[model samples]
Target: MSAHLLTHGIIHSTTDPYAQALLVRDGVIAWLGADDSADRVADPGDERRDLDGAVVVPVFVEPLARPADARDALSRGTAVVTVLAGPEDTGAAPADEDVQTVVYRHADRVDAEAAGVWLPVGTDTDPATLTGLLTASTQAGEQAYLVPDGGADAGPAAQDVALTALRSVAEELGTAALGRVRHRLVVTHSVTAEDRAFLAAAGVSATVVPDADGVLHAPVASLLADAVSVCLGAGPAGDPWAAVRSALSHPDPDERISARSAFAAATRTPLRALPDAPAAGLSVAPRLSVSAPAVFGVWDADAVAVQSPDGRVAAWSTDTRAGTPLLPALDAETALPRWRATWVDGRIAAEDVARDARDGATPA
Candidate 1:
């Protein structure tokens, strides 16, 4: 058993935005609140450390990662990842104890849910079989996902086929039954306005990669405005922050997602896309609250702010009244905040070499 008392840091929790301390015991959060009250819950043997105003937020989740990129993702503070692999490629995925791996296999049809990840429906599946597969998965308490049949080059054609297929399945299942499953769609390209409406009406969650081949392929801001539950996915290379940056810095200001939205897409939103995630059953679903897994990243940033999607509003702000947790200022031209450390299940999994040496501690 181990106990660590982390004090004097910002906890990015909606439950308590002002929480200044967090207590971790046995790889789970035990308590978190103001610094003054933290001592009451602290034990003499607990390892106490002053956070010195660092920002602590839930660890990042890479939805469409490659197995070979797991180590790179982990070092950058992504503890939870969904790796898409072929049936034979499963063995290549990372098996690290500190990393939570969800493996989705690509096949002609929706196979059984794998050990950790949910199986995805292929585009070639017929409507009748697709309906049956989705219905069965829902009935069995698993929400299956669909990988749409299109890429950046397909433009509207790819989305049309996917929507048509899903529409047919929805008609067969009835709207309510289909909604109960809370289906997810992995979109590779931008969708038409009509398709976005259909996605919202069907209650389907969409995961989008903001950029492909150095160009913006999706209008993320427009999708969010239409009430679509959009999450960000960093394919293969596992650089989620890069995706977040691309979402924030789109050339078309009207299509740019805010820093808050972009950050959530890479972190909190991906968890909702996975029902079997480690944090799925937590009381505070998207917060660093007690009884939740101690999965979070500690970073050194000048300040955190709610960035406006509107180009007119200042790119960054430090106003406490924003009612938002402080995050690193995501200036497009500047480097992102320094990743100080990453904690998974209350254990330090990775740390910056320079910071470790400066603090006279061993690098994680």
Candidate 2:
């Protein structure tokens, strides 16, 4: 059996909030706890990875990927990507070397049972088409994708359009159908507080492209302020760090979200939208643990810090007693954390060879 023990790191799991180490056995996370307890479970044949103060986080998910971006997504610590497949594209989506690809297509491309991915609908879609797609998506156990407006420059008008579109879908399809489909929105611009309330009530989740070039893209921080679930996407080839940073560096202080929160949006929130993904079963959120098909990223960070959403205090401390897990400093000024390794299904899919050699991490 392949076995590996990672120690001296922050394990961001709900299973054990203060766990500093974890053991992966035969591609499954068999044990995790404090660093001091790791030795009790350690075996002579297990490979050892010394994190050396690094932080371990669940691998990222790219929600708005395209065919062109598949190659490099895994190396950047994104293990899952929902690729936007066009009608002209033939055959199955090209497989990535390590990343899991879920195919997304326009509603007219194919029936939900055949397509298996979320059906995309827009403001321009006919009501009959929207109803059919929503009903098909519900029967197939998939969320129906909605893009309420032209991205980036859509502005405030987009919010109203989204609300109206969502209401119309609900009316035509019934609340039960809406429940089954669990609609997901791609919001390029801001959503008002009232819009947020309605969205939350309707069990909707929104995906935001933080790096969209237009001046009007809604800040992720603001989307996350209320109860509305928000996930981050920067297109297929966009940088995850840039999106995380953008969410953290909003110009208005009151609208800002914490680095940890922003990171979770990039990594964790997106997973919720992908309920049927194989990797989705890996995370055990309520317990704060992950199982086999274990996927995560290791980073070389200068310092880990705790942040508050209100922007009043920032502190650097790893004490588990603080009630919050520590994350790499992700503010606009701090250098982005350098990725040292990416573990997919408990295997090192990518790594900085020089750094691993220097750190004495032998291949398992």
- Point to the candidate with the largest TM-score: 2
- Give the CA lDDT, 0 to 100, for residue 20 in model 2: 89
Candidate 2, residue 155: CA error in Å?
5.1
Please name the candidate that would achieve the greatest lDDT relative to the true structure. Answer: 1
Give a tens-digit lDDT track for model 1, residues 1-364: 7989999887887677678899999888999999999999999899998888788888887766657767566677787776666565635347565777666645433435442333444445465665566666655555666665433334554455556666776676766665666667777666778878878887778877744554456778888899888878764334566677677777777788777788898888878766554345432235688888788888766766656655233522345455666566666655666678888778777778788788775432
TM-score of 1: 0.81
Task: Compute the lDDT of residue 184 as modeled in candidate 2.
Answer: 79
TM per candidate: 0.81, 0.82
> What ranges in model 1 sit over 4 Å off?
34-41, 90-93, 108-142, 148-156, 212-215, 276-285, 311-322, 358-364
